[model samples]
Target: MPLHRLLYTSEARLSDNASGADLMVESIVAHSQANNEKRGLTGALLYVRGTFIQALEGPLDALENTFERICHDFRHARLTLVDMSPASERMFERWSMTYLAQNDEPARLLVNRDLEELYFTVSTNAAEAMRQMRGLLLGEGKKPALEVV
Candidate 1:
C-alpha cells in the first residue's frame, strides 16, 4: 500500500455550549484514535472557532475509506478537501489522531489569526498546512516560533 496524505477543513456542527463542544471533540478524538490505530492511519486535528482542520496520512485505501466515513458524518458540515496526494512518509506517524483544541497552546498561537483567513491559507497551500499542523504538535510544551498567515 502506498502512503498518502489528505488535508481538509469543515464547519463543526456542535452545540454553542463550550463544555458540550469539548465533550464532542473528546469523543471524536477517542473514536478516531481507536479506528485509526486499527487501520494503520495517523493524523492531526485542529479545532478552533467552530472549524476543523485535519490531516490524515496512511495507505491510500485506508485514507479513502476513512474519508468516506468522515464525509457522511453529521458532525461536519461544508467539508472542503484541501489536498490529497502521495506522501513519502507520514507527517503524524506518532499519533492516531493528535487533537489540538481551542484552549491548547498551539491553538492559542493561531487564535489571533482569523479562522476564515487561516482556512483560506491552508486550503490554498498544502505545505503551509502541514507545517502549521506539525508545528502545533511539536510546539506542545516548548515555544516554537510558528507564524500562520
Candidate 2:
C-alpha cells in the first residue's frame, strides 16, 4: 500500500548525565516496533541522547493515530512535528524503529544529501543529530554497547 510520510523533530533538555540515553531509546524504538507490527506501519526511529527525530510512513489513518501516541509519548523532554510528506516506498520494511548515536558530522551530512537527492524521510536524521549532540553533551561514546539479543 502507498504511504504518507510524517516527519517530526523535537528536543528537550535532558538531565546533564549519561544514563538517560537507554530509557530514551527504549521509549520509542521498543514500543513503536511492537505497536506498529500488528498494524502494518513501517518506520524508523533515531533518538539522539537528548533529542528524538522519528520518521513514520504508512496508511494515513494508521500514521495519524500513531503520531498522536508519539506526541503524547513522555520520553522526550520536548516534542515537535517537523513535516508531512509523501513517499513512493517505505525506507524500513519491517514495522520497527532503531536507535543510534549521532557520533560525528558525517551522519548529518549524509542526511542532508539524502534529503536532497533520495526521496526518503528526514525525521530520523533529526534524531541522528540529536544523538550526536547528546553524546557530545555527556562526553562519552568512546566504546560500543554489547548488543543484547
Candidate 3:
C-alpha cells in the first residue's frame, strides 16, 4: 500500500518545570516508539517553545487513528492539521518515532530559525516544517538511540 503523511502543530501543555517537561517528553517518546512500530508508522517529532510539530507517515487508517488519539491527549491543545496527503515515501522510515526537543543536539538547527515565527506561519508552511525536521534528523549524522527493527 502507498504511504500517507500527516503533519500537525499544537500547543504543548507540558509541565512548568523544565525537568518535569523532560520526563514527560521522554515518556511520550518511549510510548510512541512502541505504538508507532506496531502500527507501521514512521515520523519525527519536534518540541520547542511550547509547541509540537510532528510529521507522521503510514497507512491512512493508522495515521488517522494516531491523529485522533493526539487530538484527545491533554498534553496537547490548539491542534492544527498542517498537512495531510499521499506521500511518495516515508521520510523517517528507519525510526518508529524520532524525538527532537529544544535541548537535543539536533535541535541546534532551530536556534538560528525563529520558532515562534514558524509556529505562527506553520499552517501556510507545512512543507518547510517537514523539511526542517528532516534536516535536523540528518544534520547530527548519528543514528537515533531508538529505531524500528
Across residues 50-76, which tens digit of lDDT does each residue of candidate 2 receive?
455666777888898988886776655
Q: Best candidate per lDDT, number?
A: 1
Q: Write down the lDDT that model 2 would get.
A: 0.56
- Clashing residue pairs for model 1: none
User: What is the overall TM-score of model 3 with all chains considered together?
Assistant: 0.83
Candidate 1 lDDT trough over 10 residues, lowest sum: 140-149
lDDT of each prediction vs. the true structure? 0.81, 0.56, 0.79
The TM-score leader among the candidates is 1
TM-score of 2: 0.60
Candidate 3 to native Cα RMSD, angstroms = 4.0
Residues 37-65 of candidate 3 have per-residue lDDT tens digits of: 99999998878678898899999999999
Cα deviation at 7, candidate 1, in Å, is 0.3
Candidate 1: segments with Cα more than 4 A from true spot: 104-120, 140-149
CA shift of 139, model 3, Å: 0.8
- Model 1 TM-score is 0.84
Q: What is the lDDT of candidate 3?
A: 0.79
TM-score of each: 0.84, 0.60, 0.83
Which is superior by TM-score, 2 or 3? Answer: 3
The alpha-carbon lDDT assigned to residue 35 of candidate 2 equals 82
